[model samples]
Target: MMISVLVSPAPPEGIAPTFGWGTFAAWDSDLYRNIVINGYSYDFSRNEYLVAFFPLLPLLIKAVMFLGLPFEIAGFLINNLAFLGAVLLVYNWVKELYSIKAARWATAVLVWCPYSLFGTVIYTEGLFLLFSTAALRAFQKKQHFWAAIWGALATATRLPGLAIMFTFLIVSWREKRSLIAYIASLCSGGGLFLYSLYCGMKFGEPLAFLKAQKAWQPAQDFWGQDWLKMFMQVLVGSRNWKAGKIVDPLHIIIVLLICLGAYLLWRSHLKLGQNKTQFGYCILAIILWLLAGSPLINTVTILGGVYLIWHFRAQLNLLATYGFCSFGIIFSSGRATSAERYTYAIISVSIALGLLLEQYPRWGYPVLILFGFLLASLAVRFSQQLWAG
Candidate 1:
């Protein structure tokens, strides 16, 4: 956090002031703080972007301020504290899956991830991690009801969270083969359902959040014909470096690499005695990529998800259901612009990478060092209001 502040120069023109808040609160942090202080407005003439941000963290910030702490302090503390809790839950959860050594590696990788800086800031990553990890832990313990409750909170934290419900359904079916599991799984989306109701009351449109998303940027659906046309153009080289919004050479490469990684990782897992389901997960991921237009963010996150499914192949149904569904929810919308941040919600990426490193200690040290270097570099850029993600 201190390095982030020191490396960042003074705020540029038109940028929101930190107002004595820490530099960590820059970028999307300001949007959250604004919502905390001013509350939501339906007036598009004002802050229409607020509708896109979920209410959990900002509301927590406001609640904490009642204890005489300022929003900055409250926001920062909440994020860090929630992250600490998440770390603990993740440690125990991974340990339950394998050994304590693997658990430690998983926790370390999560903490040292290039994107972990956002978890330490006033962003929703920390809180989302807290809820999502709790949900996973509860589900692993076979506490289906509690899992649904925690999963519902996770959904409230982020839209991708609804994907977790699929995992719950799988678990329930495998454990009891009952319809109650399906019914209970629906509870996972209760938060989004409630939010839609709130939007209906406040904006006269239950899907106002979807509409407000346009105010931020132009986003396309992954299933749209345009994405397929653009993908083909990028592949055929008919589209140059800067052709259509959809066909950036860099992002196209990212998509290709993601596909290659998933395939290679699937084969490696099978060679290691992992099940066919691992390969099935990879195939499912590819199908989603084909349909979703495979944005850079989605591509990277899906690659991570494929690796995770392979790593947790023993629990293939459990992790695969959650991983694929989460990717599906994000790609279902078609724009992968914020995927760097959105990918954080996947959580399995960090764990899977950590597990991979643990199995290959010779490669682990260098990878971690590289991760730290990129993390610090990105932190500096993000603090300076430069786009890193």
Candidate 2:
């Protein structure tokens, strides 16, 4: 549907954009394709943006290219394959926590989300989902070794992979698990740890990846004032006569929905379920929010994850923790460039909606239909190069 919508408006006369091996290589896919072909270069004068991307997906693309396929073809195939694996893992994980119906619904939500088209491109969302879901499920099933393996791969895939470690450690400590289990879970960061060492040797800074992100000049206020102020500015932009592009109705709707979602999740339980662990995460999220100095969109995604955690704390503690940790890690950096894609990667909103649909089939179907409509609209906007995010 999206491709068809965008395909009609052919390039204007003489304006020829290189459509790399089908349109799947749109936008950020070009970066991954270049990474696959040229490999990483430390020369800041040329390709420093490469450092913002993790190495695992490009490495996987290179391995796939060994089969003599075109780079774009290999990249698309890799993403689609990983997406299939991710959907299946999500289904199984939700099934373990809930029911088959809920699992099916959750898988639908995961696979067809508005921002999920990235999973079909040469992006890390698909591969990251495969690794993150596998690690989360393995940990839930008491398969610590497998969890560590997947978590390590996930960490190598995206920075947010560190969320798995936080989830693992917190859950382990809460359950009074073995020290060995906690240590094993900590191994999830092994890939990132090794990469940092390699970076230090090559680029003379173990934190070179962190330094590379400076190209984006992500907004930051360690005191939290800038973060909250930006959020409020966006929230009540209508009141500001000269707010300009910052006053987006979509953002306001998103903020209201996030607040409403958190309230709903809180009321999902009869008694307030606030505890030290939840409070600690709340503080962590606030601190991260303040330090991140990210835009309003990214903050909303984090709040969405917090709402998911608050809502499902009783039904499934593991899912809530996973959601919170994932949101925290993503928001920690403070860039809102691809906040929607990042939120979909964590996927707690989809999971929650899926279960809600299963629980209330009557209204749930209607809501799902409405959501589908919204998703289609967003897809169309994205296909047309509009600001769907």
Candidate 3:
């Protein structure tokens, strides 16, 4: 439905070739008339730095562009296919663990979510989420090899994906089957190693993403003399940092309602005491993911794990709350350019994890949602203040 909607609205014009990088290789290339064959890093026009983005997403976009489909159409088609995969996995997941209503609501929320359109930006979110969830669903059934294969694909799509095999760690430990999970995780985790090695050989460091972030100045100035002062300000009373302001009070209200819905989902989960461990893994994964990487990388691993909180009987804990705050701090303290938008992930993931802590109870769900929205409410206000120019 999404693809067709955008397809008629936008169709491809002609053919193109993009064999290499440094020529606006990422999503920007999706908008180009042709994908030029250029080198990966060097010889880039000053304005072509958009190629700094990862490779897989653009290549997918290029293939779609090759189908004579417009860029927007291609993006929609890929995201639509991803949506289908996400839906199938989520539906099967909920059906297996909960009720038919849960399945319906879960799929409905994701499919109808406007914010999720961000995933359709010739990016990896849709594909990553779909594959990761499907892998988890496979694991739930004890299909080890299939789970490993999916994890490998998932890792290929999302950089943090290599960590997802940790699920197998728990499974293996509990079931006394280490060798298989080890083999699977190793095979899937190898790319992360290879990528690092290749990057080290090329750039004299194993952490290419980190190098890229530093090279591109995506974070604070590594050499700024005011680092101490800036860090203090960001942690306490921030002045230089930026956030957003929602112009629509009604949208604010709607976001509040969504928060309420998410709260209800959490409350529903906490009712099962024995299921707390499972809940722990899902929410703990989110917290850890948030703490371990950059904003984009954190979002994928967090979302992949959070997609499986179907039991609706989670146990709320204070430690989880603290972890969320710490994660938010790091995100908000980043560089000022579009830095505020990071709050969306911080708030959403935290709330999603918090919901896993307990069933916020039906009576309190709406009020808690209001509070969550209110807390996140400042995010919009901050964004406007930052981008006021």
Candidate 4:
């Protein structure tokens, strides 16, 4: 993060950096800060609605600010610390279930993935990952009390945390676990239930959070035009997709060539070795991403995640169920915005990838190298107040 800040070009005229932290507090960061300082408010006239944001991070920042820290410092401290805790939890949990090598690779993937930029910034990704991972790990260990506590905190942090709660309930039913398991599963949603109560009292609408989401993302029918545009953009490049014509023939050509190369690589039985082939694919993927950008990423993360979960379902068990549940919710949202970041936060994807990488350590190295490059680029983009993830 420091390197990203240091390498960032100066802000353009009429633009200001966020306290020399390069604009880590841009976009949703500002909204979170507003929620912290001014508290929640709703004003359609001004197009302001704080209820769209969950209260956990802002509430934590407010608590930290009571000690005289500014919003930026408090937010940075909280998010980074929470991210570190999440890394530790993921590492230990993976090590317990798999191998130490897999655990190390998993933590590395979590840190180096480009979307991880959100974890270090003033977003719920870090806090949500920490709480959700804790809850999932505790449940795996049969620590019902801690699972419920962490699960409640997770749900309060982000809506996807509900997937963790549902995973518990489904796994308990399938396994015929004790009544305490069912109780804990239900209690896991306590945070969301409390938030709903607050919304009912404050706005006279218990589902105001869901309503406010429409402000950011207008409702659309299932598999609507927006979804089609996103998927097409991934294949043909954004310009060509939006223009409804081949604005850049080279883009589609490159995409097709990359796809062909991937298929050939999969079919080859050459003696080139797995390391070289994996590295080659990594380079091709980087080129593909460069052509298609975030739409491609969003497509790959969601679709690829589903494939990973299904392929590893038996080994992953509860984690696989959580991945499916998370995807189900994301699909219902009917928008592609932040899909990569949201999918990455699910933890199951990371663990699944880590387990896959564990068997092919050579392949893991190039993947991690690619991830590091993208991670640095994303950090610089975020620091420059540009859209990332």
For model 2, the local distance difference test gives 0.70
Error of 2 at 308 (Å): 2.4
**Worst lDDT window (10 residues) for model 2?**
10-19
lDDT of 3 at 212: 52
Q: Count the backbone clashes (under 3 Å) in each candidate.
A: 1, 0, 26, 0
RMSD to truth, every model: 7.4, 8.4, 12.3, 2.2
Per-model TM-score, in order, reads 0.77, 0.77, 0.52, 0.93
Mind giving the per-residue lDDT tens digits that candidate 1 earns over 1-389?
46546444575642332434566677778888888888766666764667787777887899999999987789989999999999998888888887788888888888887778888878888988888878877777767688778888887776778778877876777778567567768887787888888889988888777677766766455444444544454353334434645554664565576667777676677465554545455454545445343242334555566666676766444665677677677667665566656666677766776677778665566557756876787676666666655
In terms of TM-score, which candidate is strongest? 4
Residue 326 C-alpha lDDT in model 3 = 28
Candidate lDDT values, in order: 0.71, 0.70, 0.45, 0.85
lDDT comparing candidate 3 with the true structure: 0.45
The list of candidate 3 runs beyond 4 A from truth reads 1-39, 42-52, 112-114, 197-206, 221-389
- Candidate number that wins on lDDT, 2 or 4: 4
TM-score of 4: 0.93
